[model samples]
Target: MSHDNKTAAYFGARDLPDVIDYVGEFGAELVTFLPFVYWLYRAGQLGDRKVSTYRGMRPLYFFLSDDQLIEKDEPRRFVGYQKRTDPSIWGFIPNPNELIATRNAYEAFPNYRKQFQSTRFSFDKPLLVVHNKFNREWNSDTPVNFFSIDQLEQMFSRLKGYYQIVYLRHGRSGSVDGYSPDHNSLIDFDETSVMQRHPEVIDFEQHHREYGGGVAINQYKNELYAACHHFISVQGGGAHQCALFSGSLLLILHKRGPEAVHAYSNGFYQYATNPAPVCMIAFNDRQLQDGLGAFTDASLCQGRVMLGANGSRIANDLAPSRVQRKGQPVFGTDRTPEPGDVGVHF
Candidate 1:
């Protein structure tokens, strides 16, 4: 049988209807199912179609909701299949077999960056959404592929002047619906210590406490993300969310996963957005530093540089300029630097 037929057979054996794709994880929902549904909706194929997803995920499907396109939005119940177990069963369109051979979602789907742009919220400075995850996955004792407190401190110290950084690390309590810490294994990080050290950086958990009312947390997140054009995230759902915004630059510190393979080889990193956000993936601390430097340089250069996966300059359109002297103090210090004091060279 063909790969598509085999995929159908696999879902059938699990008693899942062929028309209904099941994805329990938020990352897979963004990278696979959501785009597929959007394609179906755009093609006039979702007249009576329905989507089964976790409860709080409705906001991510706001485009469909706005149009009332799908017939039903059922709650997801099946946890039998995970992308790690079988990528083929993760979504209806762009079957893994074909996706591995040709990454066409970048061209095939709607411009989600444009679709999700928000007019509700505005920031005084350029917004930088930083997402970190700490959980026991792959049976490791502590969290894997997560940003350490030191790394975050370095990131905040470097970019705080040019951007309003919002830190996000979901905890056991006060999590929104469909994203309870119970659903995913949770480990504690020293968020309080980090906040104490860097008082200028906004804590998203606290922001949600103050401003997140009535609406689902995912909806609130969507609004906040829509206003931002730059993001720093670790691997998993947060990185996937950042990847969906277009005309943006996302630096992802991913140590391992099937995503790493797809990103380096199959070009799956570019599949989420239409114009395709600049995605730089770092495999280790050294690469993370290099990627962070590229981001810093981009800001200093007035967003003229776009770095690729290996920290190599992939696109540069304008001539380099000397660092601006009149901006906020360099690196959040009280003293402002003289001309050429800040490094603008990549």
Candidate 2:
């Protein structure tokens, strides 16, 4: 099977575009989302809001303190979501396999493995499931090695009217002080260094510092997650965590406005056939103005359409075949793509 045909699945409104495209580009299928709060707990951060629960049972994963995730352990018990049963929203499907995981059977089973792992083995299938975590601690690395303007445009179009954008400025340049008198930070960041590189953005350090501690910053972020339609950033790890907290989208600057097409490699978007429609907007140059210019194009407005001549067709062109073993889906059915396919691996 070609790389683009793999199915990748995930849940939650936060960075859903990032997760979908990240996986979709690499041939992944989005199976279902484990509850969002579970991600917050895993990332070791707090969120502003709680997600609605379904069927009284929520999916979760356990990550070790060392940053390695404990793959698919047994599900854990939790207090009910704000409302126990609400109408299901549009997104990834909850694991149908887990529907068979009733409380009695869940507890009765001697070795309870997370449904994420065992379901595939049941039929010798290769379904890749991912848990999207949006905490700042994990934000240091860029998700994709390269961001194409076409891909960015597609993503922005999806989130266009869907979000109210916000731009945050770090006060000074130097290692960001996690705590300070007039200086502050959540992680080690040098606002001065960043500003030295790009001074066009506005900064409000004194104003921010007066408020005191990470609490002030946390409170502001909580309010942003709670109040804003969405937050746009050159980069935003908080956006990831906030999605679980606020159920909002996180618009990231993937490619510059002036640049047209760029390269993309392994990440969540690379794993799936069709990820949720949300995505980062592709722009001509990295500059915001240039990016906004590209976004203004009517064709680009939809956000679902990728702009590249090649990258655009990669998903639709690469369809995996469906074969059933005992009526279950398996990957072997997909035929390899011809050399002319959009994302034919070199």
Among these predictions, the greatest lDDT belongs to 1
CA RMSD of all predictions: 11.8, 18.1
243-331 per-residue lDDT for model 1 (tens digits):
66766777777665444433422444565555566666665677677667656655413322254533445222111121122333232
Q: What's the alpha carbon RMSD for model 2?
A: 18.1
TM-score for each of the candidates: 0.73, 0.29
Model 2 residue 170 lDDT score? 36
Q: Which stretches of candidate 2 lie over 4 Å from their true place?
A: 1-173, 178-206, 212-216, 235-239, 242-250, 255-278, 283-346
